[model samples]
Target: MNRFGTVVIGGGQAGLVMGYHLKRRGEDFVILEGHPRIGDSWRRRYDSLRLFSPPRYASLPGLPIPVDDCPTRDEMGDYLEQYAAHFELPVRAGVRVTRVSRDAEGFRVETDEGEYLADQVIVAGGSHAVPQRPAFASELDPAIRQLHSLEYRNPEQLADGTVLVVGAANSGTDIALEAVKTHRTLLAGRHPGQVPVDIDSGRGRMMLPIVMFVFRHVLTRRTPMGRKALAEREGHGVTLVRNKLADLDAAGVVATSRIESVRDGQPVTAEGDILPDVGTVVWCTGSGPDHSFLDLPVFEGGRVRHERGVATGEPGLMFLGLEFQFAVASGTIQGLDRDARYLLRQLRQNTVRSASRPVTVDRR
Candidate 1:
């Protein structure tokens, strides 16, 4: 088996950032990608999709986005392609990591192409890989044309009749707005809190610093009410439907506290009301971590436990690009540079230590 100092899994933004850092440090590492081409994930997004933050916030190590305005998905994809080429980061394309295990010496990563042994492993695949759907949604009549937000390309793909959009996050809200233009649309779930894309007023400018401060200091999952409010406002960017919730009143497109179950091809609400005759259901629910391929005891309480992105319990096992992995912006392009730098430092330190240590041979 070929040996590497470090192997980064997933060639997305996180993985690329980590690769760039490794290259800068003159470290021996390889990036493993599952897709046929790099940055294909960004290209596959809906044509109208644009970055939530302005391009000023979208950058990687040693490179900056050309545009200050919000970049479209295609622009971001092209930028990533250029970044990869500019840095000449070593990437192995079309190699799917089937599993990762640890031996006495180091880590063994199994892929369809072959097996690779590395002293350190970094899992950089972000959260979007696993598109989550509601459990009750599975029993729905397959004829109803249910789809997750990840699969949705455009409103044209939706059915001809009325559609129910569940979960009002950014994707849900954006899809609902788009569907309303083509099909009769009903948006479910609580509305999200939002601010204008660009606040121009002096008061708005003053509030910007305060908002950032609050976002960084006060708003956190540990705070109960703050977390609830944040969850409710997860998809605040999607513009609200012009029609008021009271006007719909659960009739045209009803909102429920929660979906209880599905009966006879209809969605039953927690209030015992059934939404019947709906032609399509689009689940915009959130996703969960999928680490089935990892065979290490690294995760704790459904999340990978780490100190500064380095797995504490498992040495040489690291995770990059995890949401809030290190700081408030851990997973985003802006935040990944710093995280990658820190991880690269840890990897280099480990490599030096391993090389310096004496290897003893076993005597029979």
Candidate 2:
């Protein structure tokens, strides 16, 4: 089997950044990617999708954003390809990692292409791999076409009748807005807190400096709703209409409370209101971590236990690009860079320790 100093799983931003750092340190490592090409995940996103943050914050280590202002999704993809080429990162694409286990030697990575033995392993797949659909959704009638946000491309694929979009996050909101142009759309779930796509606009430019202070230093996700309301109104980009759900109801788009049950080809709301005539039900719930391939004792309480990106209780096992791994920004493209750098430092320390170990021979 081929052996490596380190093996990084998933070729996204986190993996690429780790590879760059490993190269700089003169470490022998390889990146394993499930996709056929680099940045295929970003390229497959909806055509209308763009980075939530500005281009200035979207760059990885040693590579600047394409222009300087705001780079589109396609531009981001191209930049990643360029980043990979510039570093000459050793990436084995189209190789799906099936399992990772520990033995006396170290990590044993089994993939579709072949097996690899690595002294260390880095799992950087992030959280979006597994789509989370509601369990009750399966009980719905087979006639009602149900799709997750991951599978949703455009409104054309939906049935010719009314469409119900559950969850009001970015994907849910964008999908609802897109579907409204064609089918009667009903947006369900709590209103989402939003920020302006361009925070440095006409009036926003003047308050730009204060915006950072409020979002970072003062306001937080854990703030009280009243305090959050102040920031939500002033800093939050959009306002939820007093009766946004009610508006959908008035527009012939049924506005129901949380889904309770589905029986006889119908969705029964919490109030026992049954909407039987709905054609499509798009579940934009979200996703969970798909770590089925991870075979280690590092995971604790359903999450990988790591101290500042270094896996605890297990030597030479680390995780990067996990949601809230250290901070709320840990999973973001910008945040992965910091985690990658920290992980690289830990890896270098490990290498030094291994080299300094005293060699002892076994005498039979």
Candidate 3:
């Protein structure tokens, strides 16, 4: 079996950042990516996707984004590939991790290619493992095209009719605005809120640093307000940034109640209004990490039991890129820098503690 000092179970921003820190410390590690390319995850996103943050906030630790303006999905993807190449980070693409379990020596990483033995493992694979959709989605009319936001590419993918976009969050609003250009669009569900100012405006740019500071430092797991925000974050979608409720209205997209069920081969909302003319239903509901492959007792109440991304019960196991892991920005690119540093420090401390312990010999 292949062996390394550490194995990172992703090649995205989080994993790459972890690899960067590990490399800085001259640690042996490998980043395993399921996709064939380093940044295919971003490349695979919907075409209209762009970074909500400006170039400064969108960059990784070592490399600045090549764009001065908000970057497109492809630009971000290419930049990630560039970052990996520039750093010469050890990455193994096209290696799908099937399971990760504890071994006598350390940890066993099972993948489609082969097995790997590592003294430590870092899961920076992100939270969106599976595309989430309601069970009733299967009950929709077979003739009506249905897709999760993850599968949505462009309006060209939709059929020739009105489109019903479920989940009135950022993705849903963005898709609705796009769909309105070609087809009649209906946006459902209530948005959490909107940013007080336009993020791209001059004043917003000036305020970006302050907002980011609050998100990164003030609103952290250590603060009471941050803990409250984390508790509420699970139910609330991120506040709208680029697109607002006014934009959706101005774009002629009809806003409706949340989708509760399906009736007569159509989508029915909470108010019992059935949308019969919705030729396409785009589910923009959020997704969660699929930790089913993890064979560890590190979960509590359906969530990973961790203290700021460090697995509490499991040694040599760490998680990165989890929403609200330490702060509201924990899942963002800029957040990885600090998270990686903290985790690595913890790892070093653990190693030192392990090494300093007195060796007990077994008497037979």
Writing each residue's lDDT as its tens digit, candidate 1 over 202-259 gives 5555565555444444544446654665566443333432333443443344345556
Runs in model 3 lying further than 4 Å from the true structure? 351-364
Candidates ranked, most accurate by TM-score first? 3, 1, 2
Q: Write the per-residue lDDT of candidate 2 for residues 1-364, one digit (tens) a residue.
A: 6777888998888889889988998887889989998888788776666664555567898988776555666778778888999999988889999999988667899999888877789988746878777678988888889988888877877997888888766677667777877888877766654444335355544454465444433443345643545454431223331224444445555445666677776877778777756789998777777788988887778877778678888788888887656544566775677678878778755641255334332111
Per-model CA lDDT versus the true structure: 0.72, 0.73, 0.87
* Residue pairs in collision within model 3: none
lDDT score, residue 312, model 1?
79
How close is every model to the real structure, measured as TM-score?
0.83, 0.83, 0.95
Better of 1 and 2 by lDDT: 2
Q: Residue 174 CA error for candidate 1 (Å)?
A: 0.6
In model 2, which regions exceed 4 Å deviation? 67-69, 196-256, 351-364
lDDT of 3 by residue, 229-299 (tens): 88888766778888877888888999899998999889999999888778999999988887877888998
